[model samples]
Target: MSTQTEHPPAGGGAAGVAEPGQSAAPGATPRQTLTLLTVLLAVFVVPTSISGTAVALPDIGADTHATLVPLQWVVNAFNVAFACFTLAWGSVADIIGRVRAFGLGAGIYAVASLASALASNVIMLDVARALAGVGGAAIFSCGSAILSTVFDGPARGKAFALFGTVAGIGVGIGPSLSGVLVQGVGWRWVFALHTLALGLVLLALPVIARRTTEPRRQGARIDVLGSVLFILAMLLLTTAIVQGSQWGWASAGVLSLFAGTLVALALFAAVEKRRDHPMLDLSVLANGRYLALCLVPVAASFGFVTMLTYLPSYLTAVSGYSSGTAGLIMVLLTLPVFACPMLAAKLVARGVSALTLIYVSLGCLVVGDATLTLFGQNVALMAVAVPMLVTGAGMGLSAGLVDGQALEIVAPEKAGMAAGFLNTLRLGSEAIAVAIYGSLLATVLASRMRDGIGDFPGAGDPATVANEVAGGNMTGPASAVDASARGDFTDFLVRSYDSAFHTILWVLTGICLVLFLIIGALVRTSRDGREPSAATGSQAAG
Candidate 1:
């Protein structure tokens, strides 16, 4: 375990404002206020960048001539890199210094965003996105560490709450900003705009650097082998899941990837269990409270990401809305997300359990998804927006609680590992959700359309006809078919989409229900979710 010590004051004034990681003098102004804003801005930038790109994806596809699968990779590649590199960066922050690592990440992120503005093809765009993930990982890994160092007790709680709000708000505001950017300028300008803000953040780093001094650690060894094994496992598993539908679940390529993932994970476990300073601390997984908290974020975030991918399609296809209008509706789903962290913070102060808040938020997710599933096409805009608001709020409130809970189980020295583990679980869960839901929806829609049109009179080879229409190959000879045939095919496709959409909702509902059960089984109740072990000088177990 790492021992923390206070730095002797080099001078006075705001520069000596407790110097982060130290007790303050009487009437001292806490650094929490400044640190909160800085960390919030850093944290918000990543998600905002993600959402911004998402809203402009159609334009990107058109400009770069990217197919749907390529488009999926453009998003998935960044996620993969972020998931893989996060733990390594977290450990690096612990070894070198948080501020240095943070600045490095910001520099990389800025450069990557700028590079993406000039991408001429999907391949180039994906590379830029991957680099952006590397930067994002650095920011995410160190931001919380900085917060932990700067604030204590109630102030720390507020700081973390503010951090969560920034993240949630970034997600909420991303698409809207992207839409406006695309409308005002070209799509390329959207990527270009990030550099301006990033540049300002970069220039401000020196001031932040002077305020805090990080004490160097001795004999800190990074588990290079463990990190490699972990990344390999994640990559293989994600590849298997994401490509399984297109490749066929039983195909040799998919099966081999699945097998490889299992083998790598088993090896990773053995290696970590034996390592002196493993990339992740396996023992934390044994902590019931931490494990329970992990489940909520994985489940909720999974559901949320799926909504990000499919909601727009649903809006434009079934609700007779334009893509821009669909993007606007998505804002309603994300709007509550921004407010959730603040709400949770207040609730926590009033003696609420993090688990309790997570449960309530997850419950709202269930209700919202269920309502959407049941009446998506039939519901009025107001009706749909209400449930969406509730769902978004729930996700926002619970987003950062998982990290806090995970941190509680480990000793202070292992905070980086705990954070890394939680992040890994989250990324892995998100990938799985995207693959599973996507495959299920595709299959159900196709099957439903086939069945809906099967018994119609003179409808020979309905399956072939349906496949052609769904694949966007309706032109050529297919279009030369009679008007009645075209109308029947259109009706079948629409009905299939509706059925599939409903099926997806029901499936998500079941997942949420299971998540609710998992939460009840795992979390031990606490007042305001604080252990008081670190806040006070109480002994936390080894």
Candidate 2:
């Protein structure tokens, strides 16, 4: 492991030891406050940017005249770039400097946000969003890595809890905030706000206290080939998933994308394993605890974050609510995120095992997804709200506890890489979840609509009807469809949507249940034999 002594500021101590620039004091100096403020701002804003963008998607689509596929690309582009570049940026942070990487990320993010706000077309917006993801990856990796290096022991736990809480609040508030912005100003203002916030942080960056440089490893090189292969694999896989329903699952285009994904992923794994300095250290997978920690987030994010992206769209489209109202209803899904993390942190401090927390979280997720599946349609909004709350709480607890616990098992020098790896799983799962859910929803909706509308009189071309309904544009007037048949079409649209929603929810529930059992088994066996110190209770306090 690499070791380097971190120097404290003239008047401040290192992170977690004392308040910066204060002598064993409980309070922080102005400089320390600025440092914490700067880092926390980035932590909070990145998640905010993601969820806020989700809320703005409807406006973006309407303004840019984007179809469903391009709309999916708007979100997928950002997630793909963020997921692919995070580990590379993490490694680079360790190589160059965390502060420098962070500054660069913030700058890039600001510029990209401005470009997105000014984008004239869907293609430009998508490209800008993808570039912004590059910046987001750097910010996310460096923010957590910096915290891991600065704090230790119980203080590390506390700092991370705060970090998680701030992140949760950002996630919780993003949709509603974006709703207000989009409603009051315009969709453009959403990206503009991100640019403004990041610009302020950039101005304050130089004044923050700087930490000592992390020692660089000798003969270390970034795995450029591995990164390219991983990016190509993820891109191909996501493209296949997103386009499969539209193109036909067995179509040559879809099949080719899947084949390309398999090949790229195989190449990526081989290259990473052979490289002396891989972007991701494959040896970490040998540690069962570490591997479990990495995967729990993947499963959790698949169920949790995916819902956050689509639920508002559902509310607005199927439920006949305005975007602002959908944003308000989304509070049920995000509020617990703000409250549950601190509670989970307290429980962990009181000796609750991280594994136990994870197991319970998965259980909560299963129940939540199942409930949502049952109550998605032909029910009061309250029915959906209850499950959203449950799922949100589960997400909060899992996200709050897992990252800190995952870091505890790794060497401090590799903190950036570990953080990068953990988030890559998270954001990567997010990208896949969105693709799968979107495709499934579209496919099922189209199938049901086609079957139902075939017998309807004067419903115009069945293909056009199916396309419109599947795209959630059921209210649009069509000349081919008789006015008398409109009511039946609306009913069919609702039923199709409800059925699709239930199918997706059921799949997610099954995923949570299976992952819960698998993780439970891993924890039981590990506690019985391997790494008894960690399995017992040594690492749980954090």
Candidate 3:
């Protein structure tokens, strides 16, 4: 939205060619090209790290000897930190130069990743991953802002298109590539690889700093109190969701966590309202339509991202696939994401309804989650292929479309604030969705295992064994069962995991349908996802 009205350099001398006088023009083609590639390269790895780490969870658990409850932090920690700090990073980028913020973020990411690779225990690894998430927040939020700052008009569109594509590639291929690395090089290399890629980004920072220009905002502040409150609130809420089933939903600890989350949120809201430069711009959030569009990503988080993070582990445990094979199979579900954003955008541009595409996306998620129930012991791959593709396509279609549509309803100057809020919801929900899914899956698996395992001749504690299996250790605990009954117990573990997965899928279907209804009612967008009585110019309602 920061459309620097500057046109392409008249002579076009290599585009971005610095001249004797005048600041390096933003329309500098060569410089913009370098900036785009560099920023995209940094951002692509963020999603790869998000989707890929799950493939290595089992290995991390096996190596660290941790249970499911503690091990899930490996993913949750990163996501939660990213969600909480993203807005702060954006604000910071406004105060400091974007290039410096980017360099700082890249540095943190590289160091944290290196620390993660060297961690000796699960706790150490979780802390390191959380640090990386903080770094990732800056990279993800600031990268697009950088692109918006550097390129204008047609070139901007192309840059963002590539941005979305590379990110999708990262998400789509994360599981497959990670599985290979885990199998061939050990799990440590997973983080090691992140360190390596980000290091390259860091090395390019010198060139980037000299080439790019961002005017620092005069009076912007980071809103530390608001940031802390929001982060504490999210962490508490996620913790409560993760522990609710295990601690008894009504237990004092669970209730207290929920209560604490509410108090923190109330404080955050109050702080935002009072602050001169709040982390969350309350005025922007008052728009009903914009808020509804933000939820679109939340739906994807629950329906698709949950699957991306956990399905690999599920397949390895219940469907009898190795880590590498499970990752390969996941390609069927994630590949569509790589191509569908552009396809969806073109369709909208061609006069197809944007809301219609959203509905299609939501519908596909519902259908896909429901159809995935077909997966069970020895299930044929062909049977689940359609469901995976449908789900991934749903995710793909909405990729960057929601942000684009959301921007249409806001004043151009407020685009940054709106985007910040949308992404906060996007990533915050992802953290919660994944936490809840894993918790509920383990909860159900525990119940099933408890009901059936006690009857066996020589079984370990059902709760403990279920936790172990959920954390990706299937064989270690099977030793407790009598040799005659070991096979049956292992079979029971597989059946229980499959059953729990099916239950979770159904819940996801219901969530998606409800989201669709809520968004449909809120927008009143015509068949094409635009307002019925839309305004003429570039922006509609705003």
| Most lDDT-accurate candidate | 3
How do the residues 1-542 of candidate 1 rate in per-residue lDDT, one tens digit apiece? 12344322211111122554554332225444555566677788888886678768898999899999888777777777788777777776766667777889889988988988999899898899889888888888777766655554445556667777787787777777888998889888877877777777777677667676553333678789988998888788877887887787789999999999999989999999998667776765655566676677777765677786677776766666787688788888887777777778778778887667777888887888887764445568886777778767667878765555455444544555556666667767877887777677666656775655654544445545543433333343235456668766655565666777788888888898898887766554322344333212212221
Clashing pairs in 2: 11-21, 12-21
Q: Global lDDT of each model? A: 0.69, 0.73, 0.75
Position 211, candidate 1: lDDT: 72
Per-model TM against the reference:
0.85, 0.85, 0.80
* C-alpha positional error of residue 412 in candidate 1 after TM-score superposition, expressed in Å: 2.2
- Which tens-of-lDDT digit does each residue in 436-469 have in candidate 3? 7877777778888888887776667777777778
Query: Which regions of candidate 1 fall more than 4 Å away from where they truly are?
Result: 1-17, 20-30, 58-72, 213-218, 455-481, 524-542
Residue runs of model 2 more than 4 Å from their true location after superposition: 1-33, 54-74, 118-125, 183-187, 207-209, 212-219, 242-249, 313-323, 376-378, 382-384, 446-451, 458-467, 477-480, 528-542
- The candidate 2 region of ten consecutive residues with least summed lDDT is 533-542
Better of 2 and 3 by TM-score: 2
